[model samples]
Target: MLAALRVGPRRRRRLRAAIGGISDKVLTDCLHRLLASGLIERHAHAGAPPRVDYALTGSGQSLIDGPMTALGRWAVEHGDELLEAQESSSAKGL
Candidate 1:
């Protein structure tokens, strides 16, 4: 879905390629869940080639806005600790 947005909305097949091709079945299930929760909309208009686009709804964007801000603040505050953990975890594998 993130990659799909990067394309500014696109068909399922294009989104699949962008994100490394999860199976169509999984994609279908995910879309259904998102639509049910009102996070995204399945867009269709009078056109040829049967195009469908998915875009995040207003509420969905609002939901992410809050968490994204919090995540940014947390990363700023804990970045050093996170990096140290990553370095130690890598060293232990040697």
Candidate 2:
């Protein structure tokens, strides 16, 4: 979710599209959690039809720029090895 919001603010619909296969309930729950954690901000617009946008907060951006970046690099470096291990374990019925 954080990664999806990294680009900029997004509406609920856009978020749903960005994150494929996430149910509405799960998305709502995650948005609520992020809001509570101060990692994201929700903006409600006033008009004929209501609109809300979610954007990453400063702290959230920091998290992505720091720890998340490292984690992504680690995944790229070891993804093949991890997949091989998983396949081996599944074959062994472990």
Candidate 3:
């Protein structure tokens, strides 16, 4: 969820896809955790459209900015291996 928000704030659909099949239930739980920790804010706006959005709070942004750099570097190094493992597991029907 933190990773989802770290990328950017968007509607639930966008976040769901960005997080790569994070079940709505799990995403909601993660969102609640972040919100409770004061790391994120969920909002609803006025007007008939009822615009809804999510964004990282100041603390959340600060937290994500630093760790994401490190995580990204790690991902760059090990990402292909992880993806291959996932594919293998999926192919084995795990």
Tens digits of per-residue lDDT, candidate 2, 5-94, equal 999999999999999999999999999999999999999999979899999999999999999999999999999999999999999999
Note the clash tally of each candidate.
0, 0, 0
lDDT-based ranking, best first?
2, 3, 1
Q: Quantify all predictions' global Cα lDDT against the true fold.
A: 0.76, 0.97, 0.84
Which residue window of length 10 is worst by lDDT in model 1? Answer: 1-10
The residue pairs that clash in candidate 2, if any, are: none
Best by lDDT: 2
Model 3 segments more than 4 A misplaced: 74-94
Q: With candidate 3 superimposed using the best TM-score fit, by how many Å does residue 69's alpha carbon deviate from the native?
A: 1.7
Task: Please list the residue runs of candidate 2 whose C-alpha ends up more than 4 Å from where it truly belongs after superposition.
Answer: none
TM-score (C-alpha) between model 3 and the true structure: 0.68
Mind giving the per-residue lDDT tens digits that candidate 3 earns over 59-86?
9888777887789899999999999999
Clashes of 2: 0
Query: How does residue 90 of candidate 3 score in lDDT?
Result: 100
Q: Cα miss at 5, model 2 (Å)?
A: 0.4
